[model samples]
Target: MTDFLHLLHHELLLSLVIVCMLILKLADRGRSGSSWSNLLNVLLLINFAGGLLIEAEGSLFDGMFRSNALLHFEKNVLSLGLLLVGLLATPYLRNHKHSAEFHILIASTLLGMFFMLSAGHMLLFYVGLELATIPLAALAAFNLNRGESSEAGAKLILSSAFSSAFLLLGISFVYGTCGSLQFEQIALTVSGNPLQLLAFTLVFTGFAFKLSIVPFHFWTADVYQGAPIPVAAYLSVISKAAVTLVFISVLYSVFGALQATWTPYLLITALLTIITGNLFAMRQDNIKRFLAFSSIAQVGFILTGILGANVDSEGIVLYFLLIYLFSNLAAFGVAGLISAATGKESILDYRGLHASNPRLAWTLTIALFSLAGVPPTAGFFGKLFLLTSGASLGNYLFIGIAALNMVVSMYYYLRIVKAMFMETTAQPIGKIPTGVAPAIALALCIAGILVSGLSGSFYEHIHLLTLSY
Candidate 1:
């Protein structure tokens, strides 16, 4: 009871903050309303502080809500991602009318994600996933004036609903097979049953949808192309990370005995995701669509770590996720800034971006290079660790395919770079005044990439986190 209370306390505090923000927005029907930006910053700061407090205490109420070193690390990483999102939101919202509503929705979605990171039971995890997902659909449609935005929202909701059906069905099967919803109990029961194989397949399908693997990834590019850039960035970073964390937790805790059963599926998906995502991305003319395909390919790389499926694999996965968060966020941040500054969404619009906005162009370039797994950046090390782990596990084919994928990926990633640096501009692309907040966000991302590469301790810290509870 005490443990549940503690969990509820933290979860409720965040939920309450979001509710109050929403109410405040609603209450201010008159001309004089509160500054949504200020309210959002405060709310995010409070949530971040609370996450830190939970981390400091090491564990909470009891085992049901415990916070180990690994959870603490993941929580901090998530908080940092939220902070960057907040910083990116401020300028983007300043020009829009329903800024307050947007902030409140983002806050609510983030609140759900916080709970997800520490979720101990299947029911809690499912609730958190839904909470995190439902609001995002609305956010995707926030720019109702835009046709693409509306389409994005509709697609997101539809895709999420499909995934949810799979998730619920999988959960039912697991409960029927194991007679329990707790991960530990499920783990014990999974070791000895033929039915467990089907259950695992169902659960893997749900997660694969979230991860946006091939066949399950048809919705990704369309949604990214249609949604607002900030929302797209949020989906790319926060949503993906949360789902990956949940997938890792389930595999580690509830299905360790079924590793052999699942590895082949993961491998095949990884191979196809890499091939299809890269080939698809190579033909894209829209920047957002290109990135959408790029992200799908990155998910393929992440699966390699999952295939390793050991204590060390957790560290590998976390480190790669951190590197990905920074690299991918920086890429999207720059793209959002450009889109907002110039209402241009297509790759051709950026023909001569370097001539006018050299800083933004270079930032985008660095980000893209990192995405392509170029060396001297965080992504290189991230892919290196993933390959190292897979090779050590004797998954040589997986490693080889990942290596081939990187090479194939480089062609498309470099197309963006070549457009920015090599091509001549039709019209001079002027820079909007880069504010302190967005600049800081970009700097932090760049620093994370550089520091992660230079520091051995970064890898060591992730190694420590990979250990099982």
Candidate 2:
């Protein structure tokens, strides 16, 4: 137990916190209004800062578990995002019947994500993957009063089952080829063999499902639309961030031996994903579904960094997500506020939003501009760095297609901005009573996006992290 405590410092903190929350829930038993949420929120913020402060970096648990510069950086960034996400989620979760349980589940998911980020072996990765997934289904179905929530949970479970099956098949094949489940063993053993080829193909397909890459992306839009706003936000940012790190780590570290075999494939899939995701997002009326498709489009940009697989590209990818965490969450944060106040979820309902609630309108405007990759905003820098890094390796065609997708994406992202500022409706949602927690969350997101963008030191810090790993 002492060994576990020292080795997985943050994960242990999370585990203990979850237990404490569960006990608190039981103690509160059937209370009309539970204040445990406020306590949990404060505790979680402390955990996030403490997790960031811990500099202990090593491998333990027989080398199956590891924590290094890479893992530490990933955890810290994810913790910061979750800290803000928790703040944003609070307003919506306050009235939940099982609010304490919801926090417990979120902590469990984050614990699993930590495990996944640092898994040294295939079996360890699988364990972490499933742990991260199970709680999301329950969270998606949390609003049991709504039929769409139930349907979203069903779709998520079904897709997760398929992904797991594919992942297991890949694992078994790779194990048979290498006679070991350790990533180092596989890296040393794998070559251009048919078995290695088959294994990586299957494994990447599972990753594609999680990242919502093309062909495996059918479930993304509906799930995002139906789940509770906070759950949708969780899936949008947290799940994607953790999965992005693990997926690239596997491919970049273990299967790098097959780059010639995989690079072209990544490029093709990226092209298709960019085109499909942007096209789909253009037609969406629902706000969450629009961002869902937008997330898919953004993944195409992120994949380019993975395709390059260099220190600079790695830094660029992580930096992009740092700002992306803020930009995307800001948009969702505004959406949550509007939803809470007006109970309106459609883009059309956002018409003339500026007339009454200029704060919400401008907050969302900044977020949308950043997401659209417009100048002086973080999203523009994200795309610029991503394209430059990928293109440096002479990926002109893929870069060209990606640029086109950016143009396509801009049209839809600005659609909401237009609705809020330029258009008007007979029934305009006026003057949402924005609360303190949500207001702070929005400010943090905007600040993150702007500070990261204008500050070259941020890129230097990211470079230092990549060098450490």
Candidate 3:
């Protein structure tokens, strides 16, 4: 029992939060939305704090579940993301009728991600993957009155179903060839044979679907467009971060031997993803769809880091993700505020925004700058390291292509900034009041973006965490 408690403290703490949320639902009658939102915020902060303090390093359930310093750090990263999402969402969720249910789904999906981060076996990973995915479909359709929301949900369901099938087939292949489902055992037995290579391909395809890689990203824009802004932010930051952590781990550990086989494929897909995302984003008028494509392009950069196959790769990726969380959420926070206040979701709707909402315009401008990987922001540092890491692979041409895509990304990202700061509009959006919770969230994101890059402390700390790798 002591071993269980020590090894699984993070999971146990989150489970408690989920239960408490369930009980709260029963007694939620007659409660003000502010009170409910406040309570939820408190719980999320507690979980985030607990993740930082908890310490565990071991395998459990016959290696079905595991934990270590690195995994713990990754979990904390995710916890921080959830907390940020909760804080940013408070403004929109407060007074909404289904706010409680929305939070419950969010918490449930978070629990699933926790399981995913700790899984040591294929079956455990699969279960966690499903847990992490299913609730998001409901979240995508959260706007009950919006037909587009329902369409988003149906599309997500179909996409997730197909991905799961591909993943399961991959797992089955591994089991048949390696005669084991445990990652360590698979690593020991995998020989890069044709069958095993095929298995890895299938699994990679599944992850591709989840990560919104090119050719598998058809659902992303629609889903982001239809989902509530907060939910879209969660899907963009938290969901992508979780899968990215797992993808790096699986590729580095269980399939490390097959690196030679998969690197070429990753290279091709990464290029396609960057180009496709950039071109699509340039054509998008909807802010949600624009960010959705931007996120896809970011994935291509993440792949570049992963291709490094060096010690620094994991830390660089994690650091990039940290920067991305702040940068992307900052943009989304501003968008959410505008959408909630004026129902404007178009790039053109932002024309002359600085005239009335200079603060929001500036905040979004800084965010887009970061996303464009411009200097003087954390995103600049993040992309720099990712490119440097990929250069370790000695593929200058590919790295150059990736670098050029960053320039392409800049044009679209700056287009929004131009609209907000320069373009004139007859009917610009009026000044929108950001409530206390959202204001605080935006402040935090801005601080994180500005400070995290200049300090080097965050990157150093991440390096320390990944030392065990």
Candidate 4:
């Protein structure tokens, strides 16, 4: 009983989501479908709110699972992001018959992320990774009517399978060398032997695939382009953040013993990722694909900080992600809102957008500037902190290379901005209708950006909280 109580946050969220999914599956049919959707939203709201209040204080179940301030913070961030995702999804899902199932699928994926974060053992991490991947493929191809959607889903599943194989092989090697699948046990026993080196490389590759790091990121653009806008939004911010948190967690804790061997690899990967993401993003016309590459570049910066991964750096990592959450989601929300109204997904279609719908134009402008690391916004500070913290560990070369990539990225990020406000077309897209839910979500994201950047106390407080761990 006490053990279960220790996992109150995890258990309650898991149970509530499962029960709601079951209810949606069995009880709701064709009739009163909208009401059922409303109910799902409410239940999800309760689930998110309840997650914040629950006390997940320690390792539970023989230490195979544990909770900490950081994990709880990650969960809370995930919940809030997903809540807004649900709201953004409302307008898009309204017309689809399988809307309820989509919510269930998202809940399922969130469950897997929860497990991934909590897992103290390698087996549980692998289980969580697989659980997160499968449903996401389904969601990628949710629009079965489109050939691109189907193709996206298929590519995702195939990539997921390949990555899982690499992950499992790496685990096998680790187990053979360490004689244990537990993180703490593995950390003590592993060294830079031939087999252990191969294991670490393969495992890092697997994680890189999920984060869509360069060379392993072939599936990113197509999947983003093919998926529905809201699903793309979910994948861009929420899914990637989950993978990043756990990936960094494992690096600092489970594999800290291999730092001498892995640091070079991590730095090289980060540099290449930034270059590839920026160059590719420059060429993308599809908004989703563009953001996909931009996100890849952003990950490189995050990994820059992670190269200097430690207890103190953890706060900076979490802070970078929080501000990133605000900036990225805001951009996606504006894009999603406009696309839903005009059915235009091309960057070329945004000409003279500010002439009518100033809100979207301004929202997008701010978001793009944030992504470009312009001043007075969360992203500028976010990147500043990440670079400085990384350089604090004597990674000046990587920082210089990163500064170059930021310049490359700014050109493309502002390209969309230029199209909307500066350039004019013969027939500009008319004023797009903004839904209430989307409007509220955009407002929330913008406010989050301001508060995160402006409030030094809030910034220090969140950063200091990580020190306690």
The estimated TM-scores of all candidates read: 0.93, 0.97, 0.98, 0.97
What is the Cα root-mean-square deviation between model 4 and the actual structure? 1.5
- Candidate 4 C-alpha lDDT tens digits along 204-278: 989988999888999998999999988888898989989998988788888888888878888888899999999
Q: Put down candidate 3 lDDT per residue, 139-173, tens digits, no spaces.
A: 88988988998998889988999999999999999
Ranking by TM-score: 3, 2, 4, 1
Q: Name the weakest run of 10 consecutive residues (lDDT summed) in model 1.
A: 55-64
Q: Name the better of 2 and 4 by lDDT.
A: 2
Ranking by lDDT: 3, 2, 4, 1
TM-score-best of 3 and 4: 3
| Candidate lDDT values, in order | 0.81, 0.86, 0.91, 0.85
Q: Give the C-alpha lDDT of model 3.
A: 0.91
Model 1 lDDT tens row, 1-469: 5544443444666677778777877777542222566567677778777756643333443334444657766866887787788777666777678887787787777767766777777877788788888999999998879988999999999998899898888889889988988766788778647667777888888888878988799989989998888889899888898789878888877788887787788888988888899999999999999999999999988887777876688789889999899999999998888787787878888878888888889888888988998998888989988877777778676688789889999999998889888998657568666777789889989888889987889988778656645
Cα lDDT, model 1, residue 401: 76
Model 2: per-residue Cα lDDT at residue 455: 79
